[model samples]
Target: MTTTTTARPRHDAPAQRARRGSTARRETWGSAALLLLPAVALLLVLRIIPTFAALSEAVPLGSERSPWSNFAYIFSDPSFWNAVRVTLIFSIIVNPLQIALALALAVLLTKRIPAVGLWRTLILLPIAVPQAVSAIIWLVLLRPDGPLNGIATSLGLPTVPWLTDPTWALASIIIVCSWVGVGYWMTFLVTGIKEIPLSLYEASALDGAGSWRQFWSITLPGLRRPLLFVLVADTVSNFLVFAPVRILTRGGPQGGTDLLMYNISERAYTLGDTQAASAATLVLVLIVVAVVTVQFRLLPGRED
Candidate 1:
């Protein structure tokens, strides 16, 4: 009888503890939502709303107006196709080269070397410079009478036109773009490499696996996810490349460096044809989405 009375007195204890746990959970979730709300709101205002508005402008509202008319204008225009071709060529040439250079630099940096911090800082320094500034610097360096051609003349080598010639203008832009982008991409690879478990490397070493073999088996496999992410992001950014073309070449030397963005801007602002520009913009977006979809479908995910 005494033990039963004592057990009955503890009934409120369980209820109080449950209430405290529920309150703690509620507070944690509420705090998380509070922290996330600002960023979510900013994205909605800046990106989501503008994107939808642009799309609406691109497509017609009633049967009297159809987006096809605008699209037809874009498709029939030779310059539009030329710009598309140029953009595709630029992306094709630069993307693989950039990835290769970044991967090589990442591997080299990961090795046991002196002054690693200094090397990393130097590599990353380009990213700190504004894109416009970098383009201007390249423009100066590549000018006909600039340092590059001057060196060529001094060496008694025929001076190759770096930017003025149509043949060389797009190539020059690609070179500058790759130079500016490699460091940023390499940093991602470096981070991914660092995340690989050291135990795997140790085991491979114990098995007398050479550096190349170890990298192919362990490092490459570990880097797959980061590599995919970088490829997707780089592809998207490269497709929309505008700064270098605008500043260095102005899509000049016979429009050899004209990209989709440059073309769209010319239509929207310079030519005063907002509707056509909006339609072109929508098409560009579709192309990027398709490319990304294809990439993901081809790569999917890590096998093991």
Candidate 2:
């Protein structure tokens, strides 16, 4: 008797709810657009504009006789071809070397070891240092009379030329690059390894699987995506290597370390050939695109 009649359900409740949802969606879309605007604007200003500008500079607009003069100049130059060869060799060596070392370090550090955090921090310290600064530090260390040579001398080993001989110069550059890259790539693999469930490892252990067996079966499969990312990024960065080449080698020791980027810079700044530089820049971009495309096709992903 005391219970009042329940209020009649609002007839327009669903309609009101639909209107609220629509408003919320509109707000969400507006917020997303606002957040994306800055990034879009910067991309246009920095990347797109510069690419088009380089294109414009590369082509000889005034001459119908040779529209491809800049490209022809680049192709005919021995320096350009040398740069291309060096770049390819560098990619072939550095990409696999860095990834392999990184994988090894990642597996080692992920184990329950003493001072693991300290070890990781020390490895990653190179990344925190700017590339130019890192290059300078390496420059000192690699000098003929520097600490590295001194150590070799103390061990009664001949002090080999680190940056003064052609082959040794290229190797020195590779060493510097790997030193910087290994830790950075290792961090990514570590993150990938940690994502794997602990139960899987325990199950493998219970099944009498050794550490090597578990790594091959579980760790490698789990790391496919991360490995792909590291490979592509490492390839691109190695192709674009200029700082160390500039500060340390200067594409010297008989042009053995003349990477395409340093070659392009020499053309642009040192030699005052912007047209050839632009053409070389476009070539570099095309090479990167082609290599990355091949990587995407060849490498298996998580979905695969």
Q: Which structure among the candidates has the greatest TM-score? A: 2
Candidate 2 whole-model C-alpha lDDT, 0 to 1: 0.92
Tens-place lDDT per residue, model 1, 1-304, is 1112123334468777687668767777887888899999999999989988987777767859665788888999988998899988988899999999999899999988999868977987887899999999998999999999999999999997898888699999888988889999999999999999999999999999999999899999999899998899999999988888889888888988888899999999889998889888988899999999998987775666
| Per-prediction TM-score | 0.85, 0.86
> What are the runs in model 1 whose C-alpha is more than 4 Å off?
1-41, 302-304
Which run of 10 residues does model 1 get worst, by summed lDDT?
1-10
> lDDT values of the candidates?
0.88, 0.92
* Each model's backbone clash number: 0, 0
The candidate that wins on lDDT is: 2
